[model samples]
Target: MSVSVGIYSVPLVCEAVPQIGCGCLAKPVLARLEVHPDIAEAWLHHRGDVIAIKWLRELGVDQQVGLLRAALGGDGDSQVALVAAASSSPLLATFPNPSYWYQRETVDQLSQEEAHTIAARLVQRLSQARVPLPDGTALQCDLACALQEVLVVDEAMPIEARLARLLGVARDTFQQHLGSQALSQLDAWLTPAALLPEDAG
Candidate 1:
């Protein structure tokens, strides 16, 4: 008996496949697709977004003010970091609401001098936090002072790199120290409701 090998062809189902139509291939169509709502919203929020006071009532006035200053200082990376932290944190769910952009727009209405005043208050609040710099650190300045200097006062090259060197620690370590200490201090002032975990306290 001779065995015959048979090859079967499967038909390609265009409907089942996710395909861009020919119209989408056009330059004008592709150009129009560049406007992504999510990216646009994120950009708008990052550019001088405001933190709503009612949402941030869990934090002390100074901490809230400091965060606001940080957000409004044109530090998009910092704002994005804060939003990411809040999104990931079990205790900070209600913050950074979808309407947060409107609050930021309101902040934008403030005069330049007012923005400066807010930044000054933030610096003062950070100075009061008095988080210690790493041991044998080159900088003799207070940790908060150093943070403000690198983050707000100076437009230093490679801010994180310089900050790590000043703190005598790795970049990741410096970030962790700053974030954890700041969060810890803020957590101390959070309301009981805000402190509750997703399921239980």
Candidate 2:
């Protein structure tokens, strides 16, 4: 039988890539991430995004933030090792709703290309708020910090207690600048929803 690896196992396929600084991961390829606890919780809090759901379900990692953290390579592991170590969280049941991305109303009304365009625009608008970072040698510090909030917890801080502390930092920092409005918007937009299965037709 042929093995069916989910999107999490695949590389990101982006036609137009962003400018990445030195410390950032090389190439915009899609890879599994070790998401921090809070980050996972944060992802769960959002309404929709099937891609994230499919990855989580297929990986069986439970915590999305931990996935992001692992992807960040906070540990000294080589790139290959890091990818191999990503947790595999499986889907236990059908998602509560069809993937927000492919909802019948939107998909039926819009062509695939148009749907993607709309989604991208919405994501851009929703994430407009700036996420601040502590000054340091790392380039794209603000973006990195924001990315870290969504990144999975690093292996360096594998234990729950340490992970919790890291989460505390994220919540406190975001809370201060974002306050209620920013947090509300993030909750509305970035939360992962269900994605249509690859074979769905």
Candidate 3:
């Protein structure tokens, strides 16, 4: 069963996504975040796109945002981790009008695309100069910050190499999973004449 619909209007500082919406908070993606102690219970619906979170204690907006950001990935500059929560749900959530990125895929579909998703998402972020969250929060999203949000490289690694590392798989698997366009985009980004030459290339 899904979270109770009536509770969605309780208004615990809803951070509705500004534009079309974001997959960052999508149930299948961000919903996989760790549910901290602050969250008493969570329910996921609409393919994990929309979530309802019951707080253990009352928290302010900043606290909620900070906690969610921390869970999404605050270990470094940008990397959101894939965590397994000991709860009925996998995401850090809260009550709202019941909406987020609606990807509309089943659990099997999500798993099928899970591999290389982090890397691909990082690559995808390259296109957006600004990253928006569920509550219309916009953060300056530069290449380095974007990489920091997802990929972790202890040693030196180029953009492609780092992305590959984030993929956590062989080249064949990455190609098979993400396909040619993502790779081609990476290649294009790496070119000397690529856009944002001053930034990560």
TM-score of each: 0.19, 0.22, 0.29
lDDT value for model 1? 0.29
TM-score-superior candidate, 1 or 2? 2
Candidate 2, position 192, lDDT = 22
Give the per-residue lDDT digits (tens) of candidate 3, residues 102-147. Answer: 2223222232233233334444454452422222112222332333
Superposing every Cα of model 2 onto the true structure, what RMSD results? 17.9
* Regions more than 4 Å wrong, model 2: 1-123, 127-140, 149-174, 193-201
Q: Which candidate is the best by TM-score?
A: 3
Q: Which regions of candidate 1 deviate over 4 angstroms?
A: 1-109, 133-177, 189-201
RMSD list, candidates in order: 23.6, 17.9, 14.3
Model 3 worst lDDT run, 10 consecutive residues? 5-14
Q: Rank the candidates by lDDT, best first.
A: 3, 2, 1
True-structure lDDT of candidate 2 = 0.29
Report lDDT (Cα) of residue 121, candidate 3.
Answer: 41
